[model samples]
Target: MLYWLIKHVLLGPVLRIFFRPEIEGKENIPAEGGVLLASNHLAVSDSFFLPLMVPRRVTFPAKIEYFTEPGIKGRLKKAFFTGVGQIPIDRSGASAAQAALDTGVRLLREGNLMGIYPEGTRSPDGRLYRGKTGIARIALQAGVPVVPIAMFGTDKANPIGSKMWRPTKIRIKVGEPLDFSRYSGLDGDRFIERSITDEIMYALMELSGQEYVDMYAAKAKEQAQPLPDRLPESRAS
Candidate 1:
């Protein structure tokens, strides 16, 4: 009920009036099914714009921090995410990763559309990064089709760490469904998982036209970090 009210009666109408997102390849989305929407994460707005444009209710696993913040502000944030159909989960370490995967699989088994960022994190430089294999595991475990989606120009609308969103034009390019039925019951194969993940990343690269980086987005961000300042050298020491 909250999701419906927010998407249809409240925020959706306001966002559409301003952003006016252009959605292409709407035909690619299945009318009804347990499916995976694997997308390239570019900006914070990707979550909002993608859900707003899609006819079906899209759910993503958001960081538990969004739901656990303190005070009135935190309460509002939690309310908004819950209202928008997002599931809050821990995203810290290996165990958390597995937990998130389990959550996604359960959602799919229940016939819900699940949105995932295979890059594991947003592109630090607006380029596609190597995908994590969790998405493949979810698809294979749930026995669902993976639809590759590319969210364009969302970075311009809401750049990384930007609190305010601009009314910028954006496009959503949806690719055809990728079926991995043959890989069903083979989720334990790491090699097959990598193959599937790479294929999905390639589709995203083609759709978004972003340069592909072979490193994980989070690792790339770590590599791009600036080195700490060096202390001034003592004269003739």
Candidate 2:
């Protein structure tokens, strides 16, 4: 009820008016059944826009911090996220990856559309990064097809450090679902998981037309920061 209200009555109408988001190949999404939406992470708005455009309720795993903070502000934040249908998963500890995978598989098995970012984190430089294998693992375990979704212009609208969204044209391209039924029993195989993840990334690269970086986005972000002591290059010849 809250989800529908927010998507339709409250936030959705406002976003649609300003951004005027567009979508292509939306028919590729399955009409029914459990499926995984494997999307490239760009801006934070990727979560908001994708769900707004899709017909069904999309559930994404949010970091546990969003729900576990202290005070009244934290309580409100937790309530809002929970009301909007996000699952909280601890992104710390050794079991984090496995816990997330389990959450996705369970959602898929329950006939829900589970949205996942295979790249694990937002791209620091707007290029498609190598995908983590957890998405592939979930797909194989859930025995569902993976639909590749590419988001464009979201970074411009809601940039990495920006607090407010600007009115930028947003576009979404949905690629045909990739079926890995051939590898039905190969979920636990690391080699197969990597292969599947690579294939999904390839599809996203083609759809988004972004340069494919063979590194994880989180690592790229870490390497992109300049040292505090580094001096600016001299302009003097």
Candidate 3:
């Protein structure tokens, strides 16, 4: 109810006017079934824009903190994310990541599209990064096609911590649905996951026209920061 209300009544109509997203190959998305939307995380708006353009409702697992924080800000945060149909997942560590994938798989099993950032977190830099294999695991577990979606230019609209929205032409390109059934059944080989990750990235590379980095997106993002500890999940050592 809340999701539809926002999608139709409130926010949707407004966003449709200003942040006009030029979507390409939208037909690549399955008509009515579960699918894994593996997309590059460029900006916060990336989440809403793609889902808004799609006919089917896509669900992404947001960080749990978005819902559990206390106070007025927390309440607003919860309302905003829930209205967009984001499920909360804990990103504490590996176990939590598995749990997140588990939740995503559950959604897919129910014939719902599950959107994920294989890079695990937002890429501070615009460069493409390596994706974790959790997406592959879900693809195997749920028997759903993985659709690689790439987004560009939204980063300029909302860069890092700008309060107001900027006018930037957003481009979203969808790739053909990729089937991994043959490799999905492989016995716990790391190569299988790596291959799946490469397939998705290759599609994104073609769509976004960005140089592909064999490293993790989160790591590329971390390197841009001056923090004492800048390691990211699934970093290529």
TM-score between candidate 2 and the true structure: 0.94
The C-alpha lDDT values of all candidates are: 0.92, 0.92, 0.85
Candidate 3 Cα misplacement greater than 4 A, ranges: 227-237
- Write out the backbone clash pairs for model 3: none
Model 3 scores worst on lDDT over the 10 consecutive residues at 181-190
lDDT (tens digit, per residue) of candidate 2 on 18-134: 999989998999989999999999988998999999999999899999999999999988988876678899988768978888889999999999899999999998999999998
Candidate 2 residue spans exceeding 4 A from truth: 228-237
Write one digit per residue (lDDT tens) for candidate 1, span 1-237. 898899888998888888888899989999898989999998988888899889999999999999999999999999999988899989889899899999999999999999999998889998999999999999999999999999988999898889999888889999999999988899979999999999999999998899999999999999899999999989994
Q: Each candidate's TM vs. the true structure? A: 0.96, 0.94, 0.91
lDDT of 3 by residue, 1-237 (tens): 999998888988888788787888899999888899999888888888988888889898998998998999999989989999898999898899789878988899999988988877777678788888888888888889999899888899888788887988888889899998887567257788888878888888887788778888766766777768856679587
lDDT winner between 2 and 3, please give it: 2
Give the backbone clash total of model 2. 0
